[model samples]
Structure formats: structure tokens, C-alpha cells
Target chain A: MRRRTEPPGLTLAERKRQLVRDELGDAALRLLARQGFEETTVDQLAAAAGVSRRTFFRYFASKEDVVISFIGLVGEQIVAEVEARPAGEPPAVAIREAVKAVTVEDFTENREKSVALIRHTLQIPALRARFAERQDLLRDDIAEALARRQDLPEPTPRLHFAAGLGLLAFAGALKHWAEVDGHADPAAVLDAAFTEAGKAFAL
Target chain B: MRRRTEPPGLTLAERKRQLVRDELGDAALRLLARQGFEETTVDQLAAAAGVSRRTFFRYFASKEDVVISFIGLVGEQIVAEVEARPAGEPPAVAIREAVKAVTVEDFTENREKSVALIRHTLQIPALRARFAERQDLLRDDIAEALARRQDLPEPTPRLHFAAGLGLLAFAGALKHWAEVDGHADPAAVLDAAFTEAGKAFAL
Candidate 1:
């Protein structure tokens, strides 16, 4: 009624809640990269963000959860970009582009910091398991996006299978890059993985 | 000492030791299948096999470890059968055959029981994590076997990526079969998954 066009949905409380969550996530990431995951405590994370320890627990269960939620943004980008791809494009090519696009969009800033965060995340077995668990959620989003692009009634087994196959290649590429300490261009490694992926199937 | 042609290398003591382990594993499986994983106790398992609790811990670290070690046989069969596949076959076809072979060679004995075990395993978050942990080892073995068939000097990242892709399809097929309560021919479902896969790649 006041002629406000911005943020048409959120009430005053929801916006503040989101802002606090973001601040905590940013602080959590900074601490994780600098102090390492195991060394970074929740108290320290909250202190960095100017939030109470209780506030931290309200949003995240642990440092691992914060990191997962941070990178979960990339998963969202992948879905949005896949749906953004031309409908006429083949599902495989769309998937490949969608994966690549997430990096370009989400990782445009803090490239080195993001890499450091990821390196630290993978070194811890618990974090890696948490990350692997997150992938299923990503897989579902990818499958749903691919289905909409292909004009299917719903995400069929084929779309889900292809989505999984593509993500596996993406994961492999990430592993290869991470294993080598990221000396090479990770984007190129991912691109190659996508290109050379289905060659096993004579693609 | 009486010489035996069987197990040409293992000493009598070693042979007997291996026998007890297998017997314990069998008992554990029978108990786990009849009773739920959470409901079954190590003491009950040992009693079923007529072995001591000390003997149970002698082989497995925990109940979860026992189940992982049990299903781990399928992972080994996957590697062995993949390596045994004809070298001339495309890596995709070889992977498909290899996955199918594991089920036939291993699951033929107790298909329903195995499925129940898997369902229970998947339902329990901890068991699912442990099972997922075991899969990385299996993936490495698959990469190595595929490399051997492809005549690669080493398991290249590409081989690993392709192996992951193929496995992803196999997993999708398995999930489809499992979701339907294994009411259909699982192998056919897997076959269809593999066949329909890479159709996204313009195959």
C-alpha cells in the first residue's frame, strides 16, 4: 500500500532471520578456512558474526552444517541455470552447461577462499560424509530441472539416472582437482569430465 | 603333518580361523534378516553361531561393520566380474554386464533376504552412511578393473569418472527396483537404466 516494490513477500521478522543466518554462515566459513574445520568452534563462529552461541545453534547444527548450507547455494544455481538453458537443447548438454554455469555465477568472488574452504571440508571424514549426504538433495533438484526442460510430465527414471550420472562426473572432476591440490584450472577439469563422461557408453 | 591339496597355502590353523569367521558372518546375517538390525544384538548373533562374544569382536568392530563386510562381497564380485568381462567390449557395456553379474553371482542365493538387508541398511541413517563409505572403496576397485580392460597404464581420472557415471545408472536402477519392493526383475530394471542412459548424450 505504501508503494513498496522491493521484497514483496517477507514480513519484518523473516528478513531479519535470513540476515542473521547469512551473517553466521559468512562467519562460519571465514573461521573454517582460517582456523580449519576441527579447530573452528561454534562459540568462535558466533563471536565472529556478533551473534550468541544460541543463535548459531538455532540456524546450524555444526560447522559442517554451515559449510554445507553455504555450498548449497551452488546446488540452487545449478537448478536455476539448467532450467534457464534453451528447451531445444539436449538434456545432456544442458546438464553439462548447468554444472559449469554454477561455478561461473556462484564462484565469481572469493575464488581462492572457496577453494580453501572446500579443501578443509574434504580433509575431514565427517565433513565429506555430510557433503555426500547433501548431494542427494542436489540430485533431486537437477532431475526436476532436467524434466521441466525436456517437457516431460515429471522427472522420470531416465532423467534422474542422467542427472545422477552427470553429477557423478562433476563429483569426480571435483575430486581429481582437489586431490591434485587445485594446481590446474578446476573449471577445465570439470568441463573435461562432462565432455568425456558418457564415452564409457560410446557417447 | 597331514598334507592337503585344498587351500595349498593356508595352514590348518588359518583354515580353521577363516571357517569360524564365515560361520559367524552367516549367523549374523540370518539373525539380522529374521530380526531387525537395531533389534539384533551381538550376543544373540554369537549364540546363533555357537561362538563367544569375544569371538564376534575378534572379526568385526561392530554390528554395522559386520553388515558392511557382508554386503562387501558384492563389491568384490563386481570388480572380479568386471575384470573378467571381454576386453573388446566398450567400457559402458562392460560396466553394465559387470553390474548385472554381481547380482546374478551373488544375489541368486538369497535375493529377497539381500533386498531386505539393503532396505534396512538404507533406512538406518548410520548404516546408510557406512554403506556409502564402503562404496568409495568399491568405486576404486571398479576404476582399476576398467583401466585393466581398457589397457590404460593407470586408472586415469577419465576412467574413474566414467566408472562413476555407470555406477550412478546402476544405483538409479537399484533404487527403482527397491522402491517397488523388488516386485520386478531387478536385472531388467538395471538393463533398462543402462540402455536408456546416455540417450541424453545423443546416443
Candidate 2:
């Protein structure tokens, strides 16, 4: 049996790094919310976070990168889940399962914060572009995962199809969930979206 | 039977306007090809095209918008074809036919130019963002067509699914065709992609 290597559970150094990064991101978001994204500067963000100007650059390459810091964790968790699915599952099932596994719990846990961040990102054009780029990365990662499955057919169109559909479900669910405030759990909305997709495809 | 309303076959005034737009776009492309996107400016483009600064702004909102001028026509043609398909066809089939109708002769006619344009757009960040926005428009049009089909179920997930899948195939085919120096016609590549999608989905 293959042993699963878990993510290094936050070492002291790593935990400190994450705390600093989160503080910086929170400061950036607060500024963006108060004074539009275009008006907010790295200096303001650094000062708000109680860090040196250099520390902001240490955490993020650009202001746009800071806006999407959460995506790195989301991407890692989705890829890890996809990689860990049961052997011999079909590509579509595997991708869907992976997406569902990551989103079901995470989205529920951070519904309010997630919605707020999404609204902020959507309102800012540059941040929206970065968000799309992040989604593209996730799509490519899913594609790569599908490509590596030996049980799948050669030149697997299902790989792209599955990944694309999974993303569509994610985007559609997120949009719908954001539109309705205090309606239902975001995970349930995602489940319903997936159920709708499965029915649409008659899977 | 509903009578088709063609776009008034370009009035003389419209023809003159199109001619100027094309000339300006060609001049801009020439500049872009030589000097690269970032180094080129609207003033330089206006001078190269023999147009005033005001006229340049009238024609294109930005340099990035100029790169995506052809997309509006493509979107119109695709949506028209989708809406014109024989009644009672499956939504996916209608979408496939719609994409086929627009791409077949149009893409082949301008094969080299299309490939160069796609390559340039992919290489430029601003152009790629505009391209993605245009693609989102195409997806919305496809979704609208799918939603209008009486054969599909209510609150249709298939519309979203089919639109997303169709765009993915279109993108994948375009990238593949551009990579190969436009050796094969883009329409044929897209057709093959749709066929592959059908097989993948067991549709």
C-alpha cells in the first residue's frame, strides 16, 4: 500500500509566516474595501499590517497577488484530493470527486469570508483577472492529473471535459451562492449544483 | 417560418466606416508586430494609420480592444447560427452546428492572419484578458440559445454545461491549430474537438 504524505502541519516558522501573510492580506482587503483597489498602495498595506515595506514584497510579488493569496491554498487542496482519489476511477468521476471533497468542507467553513472576498475580487477588474488566472491554474492541474491516470484512454478528451465541467460547476455554484444571502449552506448549494450537472449529463 | 434578418449588408456609410477601422487595425498590428505591445502607444498607432487621436479613440477603446476587433463578428455569426438551427435538435447538437457554421469557411479564409492574431493575443496579457472577456460573451450567447430550446429541461443545467464544454473545445482547438502553424483549418480542428467531446461524454 502506498503511504499518504500529509501536508507538514504548520511548523512554528511556517505558522508565523502564515500569520504574517494573513495579517498583510487582511490589511490589504480592509484598504481595498474602504478606498477602491486602484487607490490602495503597498505602503498603506504594509503599514496597516504593522510590517516593513519590504515585508509586503516578501509575501506577495504584487498588489494583485495579495488579493488572491487564498487561491494558493485552495489550489493545493484540490490537487491533493484529486491525486488521492481511489485508483481506477474514471477521469470525470475522479475530477468531480476531487472538487467536491475540497469544496464541501472548506466552502462551508468559510462561507462569509469567502463571499466577501469574492465580492471584493469581482468589483476590482485586476483582481478579477487574477482570479480567472488562478482558476486556469486549477484547470490545468486537473488536466495534468487526468493525463497521468494509466487506466484512462490515450488522448483522453474526458480529461479536459471533466475538468472543464468541474470548473463550470464550481463557478456556477459560487455565483448562485453569492447572489442569495443567508439562503442555505454553500456546500449544499454546491451539492445541488453537482446534482444538477449529473442529471444534465445523465450520469 | 421566421425570416432571417441579415445585418443590412453593410450600407455605403457602414462600408466606409469598416474600411477605416480595418486600415487602422492593420496599421496597429504592423506596429505591434514590429515594436511589441507594451512599447507601442495609441498616438504612434494613430500617426501610423493616418488618423487623428480622437478618431483612434472612436474606433477602438484601447490598444487591447483593437486586437479583439474580429471577435464581435465571430460572436454574432455563432449566435445567429445557433438560433437558426433546425427546430427540435438537441441543445448540444445545435451548439455544435452553430460553431461549425461560423468557423468552417470564415476561419479557413483567413487562416494565417487568424493564427498570427491568436498567437499575438496569447503572448500579450492585456489582449488575453480582452480575449477571455469576448469568450465569456460567446458563452453567454450559447447559454441563451440553449436556454431557449424547448426540448431542454427547465432550469437547464445542460445549457451551462454545453456552453462551457463548447468554449473549452473551441479554445483547445484554437491553441492546437495555432501551435501547428495553422497547417489544418481551424474549423476542421474544432469539428474534431466536438466529435471528441461527444465521445468523451458518450452523448
Candidate 3:
């Protein structure tokens, strides 16, 4: 439901192509959640998004890729957000804010649908494997972001560990949030998880 | 390469069964590492271990299961080690010791074969997925271990976060160890990773 801005430098064709890609992703998530991930077909996704099957293929290689691509996009946004965080912030705080910027802001307005989609994604083995793969890349990107934020020459082991820990906290919080049917604000749960992690580490 | 004690309560037949299972796992790892995972078949594994194909099936459902069961056994042993840590040790230190007990002690004399098997496991998609799935269960078991150590009724969110963070550090350290061809002592790298994690969390 979050509307992403088309870059101002994009020409009409480029901007339209981006819009169509987003439409397909949106339709894919909805259909996958409603009809079930295993049951959803690529043709149905293309039809629902008002794009040709060929166009869908152009944007995404397969149905699994459609969902995986969305996750990849979110991961990239999270890394970008981390890089954009003010340099003075603590590493953990910056990482937390980066996650919050992408997930909390986007999901707050559509908690029910977000919860349904996340729950569905976790249930499918193919998606879970893909998610794990994306998570490995995401962790590395976060470590690099932390290094840049701290003005380090490159990511150190400590930075990588921090990145991994921060993401682990987020995952644990998200799992709990989804399990509870999103009754509590996702942001609050996430913050609490980070705070708990801080305490655990401090001990 | 690690030798496990048969539980004293087991009958002679049960002890023999356990030994045969261990033999198959050992043979599977050696064959999978030397010949490649996909290239190694069940018959080869059975032959290498001096067991019939039917007997191999009785012990393990498949070649992947042969590798995964070794991982599962290691995880269980780690949990048991955690339970056996000195009651007064700090939680992180205790968890670290638990890992050293299972991994450092077992792999020290067998570093080359361990590294080869680990590297191969990471390269195979099916094995990687199974590893991720096993990791999830392992994390939960670790959380339970932490909870029991602290006399908590159940695994708190903080406990789960700590378990995840601990495992993440181990994974990052192991990746580094294997990357460098295991020239450095695995325990030393693992310890440094945990120390770095401790510092990162404190920040």
C-alpha cells in the first residue's frame, strides 16, 4: 500500500515501466495471500495486474521470484536507509531506525494485510529458502552500511556482528508480531526487541 | 572424528545401532566431501560404511538425512553441553563454552575434513535449506537451554534473541574460518567473533 515515488529524472517510458513492475508486485502479494502461495498462478497475477504474461515475465522470472523480489527490494531499501541515517547515531540505533523506516512506516497503515502476507510467506518452503538467502545478503549489506556510517575503511568483524545481531532482533520481533496477529504496534514490538537485545548484550 | 559414548542405559543391540548410524554419517561426510554431494549416492555411502543399502535406509532416510543427522547430533550435544556449564558462569560465556565443547573439541583434530564438509554443505541448495531449517530448531533449543539455566519457566523473547545472536556470531566466524582454509584455530576465530559481538552489543 506504500506508494514509492518515481525518480524525477526518469523519462515517461522508464517511469511507466517502473509503475507496471510495482503493479505486478502488488497484485502478486495480494493474490498469493488470498488464494494461497502454492495455488497462485503467474497468469492470474499478470491478469490481475492488467499486464501481459510476457510483461510479467519481463519483470519477474517466476512466481517465486515475484515474492522474493519484493523481499529483495525491501532489503535494499533497508540498507539505503541505514546509509542515509545520520552519522552521529549509535550503530545499533541507526540499524534499528533503518529497519523501522522500511517496515514500520510501510506496514503500520496496513497491518492486517501485512500480517497475512508475512504469515503466508513463512509457511512456504520455497519462499523460506529464498528468504534465508536474501537474509544473508541483507546482513552483509547492513554491515557495509554500518562501516560507511562510522567512516570505517571497510566492514570489521564487530560491525558484521552488530549487523547480524540487529537483524536477528528484528526477525525475532517480527515473528512474535506476526504470531500475535499484529495486535500490538509492530514498531513497539521491534523497539522492545532491540532494547532487550541491548540488555542481553550488556549482561 | 568425534567419538560419542553410548548411553549406559542402552541395550547391546541399541548400542550397535547407534554405532552403525555414526559409521554411515562418517562415511557420508567423507564421500560427500571427496566425491561431491550430488555425485555421491546412497549405495556408495552404504558401501563405504560397510552397511547394506537396506540397513542404510533403516538408519537414514536419504543421503541428505545422513549429513543433517550429524548436524542434529552436534546441536543436541551443544545443548547438553550448555546445560552442563558451571551455574555461575555468565550467560554469553556459558553459551560460548557450549559451542566450544561441541565444535572446537570435535573439529580440532579433524579441521580439514570438517572444513571440506562444511564448505560442501554451504554450496548445495538442498543442504543449505535443511541447514537453515535445522538452525531454526537449534536456536529454539538454545533458548530453552538458556531459560533452563536461568530457572525460567519458558524461553523469554530476550533469551531467544540472545540464542539467535550467539548462533549468528558462530556462523559468521565459521564462514571466515572456512574461507581462510582453516589455517587459524577455529576456536580462536570463534572466540574473537563472540568477543566482537559482546563489544558490538555493548555499544
Candidate 4:
């Protein structure tokens, strides 16, 4: 049950690069949420984050890549959270907790921001296409992490299935949360989704 | 259960239009499968289907739309199958049977064609983007059909969840089937995905 407060080891240069990337993500998300993704420009993103246009490119490939990198960061957190779970924890429980930990954090006070960002990501054709690809990669990452935690050399179908189900629950909850215009706590909605899935399967 | 052999009482003109559309879909799928989506031209598709190039636009909006229309046709069949299920069937079972009936028909002897079309659809950026949107619309359509069968005025969260899960299983099975280069029976793969979900949820 160890929690990662931060990565343990990083050179000063690496840490500085990580800081710049995080700053860009923060700025990009805020700008996109407030101004609409279609209208936002790379210059605006760079200016908002106090970085040059060249600096932004050094960190990310495009405006869309910034949002994707943000998602990738959360995915890495979920994997780390899963890896840090107790060895004896059930696979489902570990995945559930790991997903909840990362997602709930994203939706806390920044709930509306996250919702707007997600809406843009889903509604915009380019982002939506990338999102599907990201989901697949994230699912594999979760399954691989679960395999590692269980001391298995390779991920099994069962592990992949569990990862997929976890993602399904996450997606279902997000859909519900967005449908309600983010009025409900996403974490609570997620729990209900998991419960519904549990009940349906229990039969 | 009444299986619809054909839509009852189409005008001769309507039937003619339907035949032309189906012919185009068949030709488009075949050409796209063999020649690659990017390389295939509308002229070639029209020639193969024995139709004027202008008639292709009469039925579909674009090359990609032909593939989407093909998918939409199958989605309609899925909804119809779900609607036609006996009233006493459980929601999950009804959805499972409906999806299996329609999808299995699709993957039968035409397995390789399906595999190629699906691969092209997934691998091509424009098609992949549209596919994600199509999946969303199809989920709602399935849920609405389920709700109608249950005599509800609108679909419930449970029904939507059920629909989402069914699509998730279908997608997973498709992924597995494609991974094996279509060597496996898609229906059996789908059944395995559903069983795995049931086991995971039973916990």
C-alpha cells in the first residue's frame, strides 16, 4: 500500500523538462477548456505557459499532443498506482482502485475543466481518433502492470479482459458524468458503474 | 421470433434503389479489401458495381461513407434482432443473442472479406475516426431498442450500460480475431469475451 508522492530519481535537467511539460499541460488544458479547442493556437498555449513556441515543440508535437500527453501522464499514474498495490490484493480491486485514484484526482475541483476537455476530445474528430488509440495503449499498459504485480512474465487473456472491463467501467462512468453535465461526483458515478457491472456479472 | 426476410412492401423504385446501394457496398468492400482503401478510386468502384459514378453519390456521401453505410446497415440489423427477441429474455442474454446472430452472419464464409474491411477501416485514419463515432451511435440505438422491448419510454442507465458492455465485448472479440489474422471463429471469440466479463463481474 505504498503511494508514489513523486518519482524518486531524476537528473536536474530531466526534472526541469518534466516541470516544463507539466506547466504546458496545465496551460493547454485551461486554455482549451475556456476558449474552445478549435480556436486555441500553439502561440497562445506557449504564451500562457511562459514558454517560447520552440520550447513547446520541444516538449510536445502539437496542441492535440499536449492533451494526449496529459492523458498519458494520468495513465502512467494509474499504472504506478496499480503496481504499488498490495501483492495480495485481488486483480479487480487493484485495477478499480488504481483507476479511481487517478481519475477522481482529475475530476476533483477541476471537474468542469476535465469535463470540457473530455467533451472537446470526444467531439473533435482528430482528438476522438487519437483517444481511441490511447485507450487501447492504456488498456495494454494496465494489463502489463497487473501482470507484473502478479509476478507473471506475460499478461494473460484474463488480465487483458480485466483491464478492458476496468476501462469499460471508467468509460461508462465518464459518459454518465458528462450526460449529467458533471453535476455528480465522477468517483461516485464510477462506483455505481462498477457495482452495476458486478451485479450484472454476478448473475 | 419473427425474422425479417425483407422489409415488407417496398415500392419497385425503392427496391431498385436498395439493390443498387447493396451492389455498390459489395463492390466497394471487395475493391477496398483487395486494392487498399487509399488506392481505390470511385470510378473503379462504379465500374465494378455496373453503375454510373453519379449513382454512387446518390446512395453514399463518400468512399468512407460507403464503408460507414455498410456498418450502419449491420447496426440496423442488430437493433432489429434485439427488438425481435422474446419478451421474457434477460436484457444481457437478449443483447448477446441479437449481436451474435447479426455479427456471426457477417463473419461466416465472408470472414476474410470482413477481416480485410475491418482492418482497413481501423487502420485508415479517416475510417477509424468515423468508426468511433459510429460505435457511439450504435450503442444508443441498441440501448433504445432494448428499452422499447422492455416497454420503457426511454432507455435506462442499466440498458445503456448493457449496450456499452455488449459493444465492448464485440470490439474485444474483433480485436482478438484480427490479432490471430482471422484464423479464429469470431462468434466463439465473442462468447469467450462475454464469459470472461461474466466471471470478472461475478466477483
The model with the greatest TM-score is 2
Per-residue lDDT over B1-203 for candidate 4, one digit per residue giving the tens place of the 0 to 100 score: 43345467666667878988888998888788788878988888888999888988888888789887767888899899999998777777887788789888778778877787778777886687677667767878998998999788998777776776677677777767877788987778888987775565444
Q: Is candidate 2 or candidate 3 better by lDDT?
A: 3
Candidate 3 vs. true structure, TM-score = 0.78
Query: Can you write out model 3's per-residue Cα lDDT over B1-203, one digit (the tens) per residue?
Result: 33465567776777888888888888788777778888877899999999788999999866678877767888898899887777677668888888887898677788887787678667786787677667766888988898888788898887787787788777777778889888888789989888878888664
Please list the residue runs of candidate 4 whose C-alpha ends up more than 4 Å from where it truly belongs after superposition. Answer: A1-35, A38-68, A122-130, A175-187, B1-69, B121-130, B177-187
| TM-scores, all models, native as reference | 0.77, 0.81, 0.78, 0.74
After superposition, which runs of candidate 1 have C-alpha atoms over 4 Å from their true positions?
A1-23, A30-55, A176-190, B1-66, B122-126, B179-187
- Using DockQ as the yardstick, the better of models 3 and 4 is 3
Task: Give the top-scoring candidate (lDDT).
Answer: 3
Q: TM-score of candidate 1 restricted to chain B?
A: 0.80
Estimate the overall C-alpha local distance difference test score of candidate 3.
Answer: 0.81
lDDT-based ranking: 3, 4, 1, 2
Q: Which candidate should be chosen as best, given DockQ against the real structure? A: 3
Off by over 4 Å in 3: A1-66, A123-126, A151-153, B1-68, B86-88, B122-129
In model 3 chain A, where is the ten-residue run with the lowest total lDDT?
A: A1-10
- Candidate 2 chain A has its poorest 10 consecutive residues by lDDT at A194-203
Residue B31 lDDT, candidate 1, scale 0-100: 84
DockQ for candidate 2, C-alpha atoms: 0.29
CAPRI-style docking class of model 4 based on DockQ: acceptable
Residue pair clashes in candidate 1: none
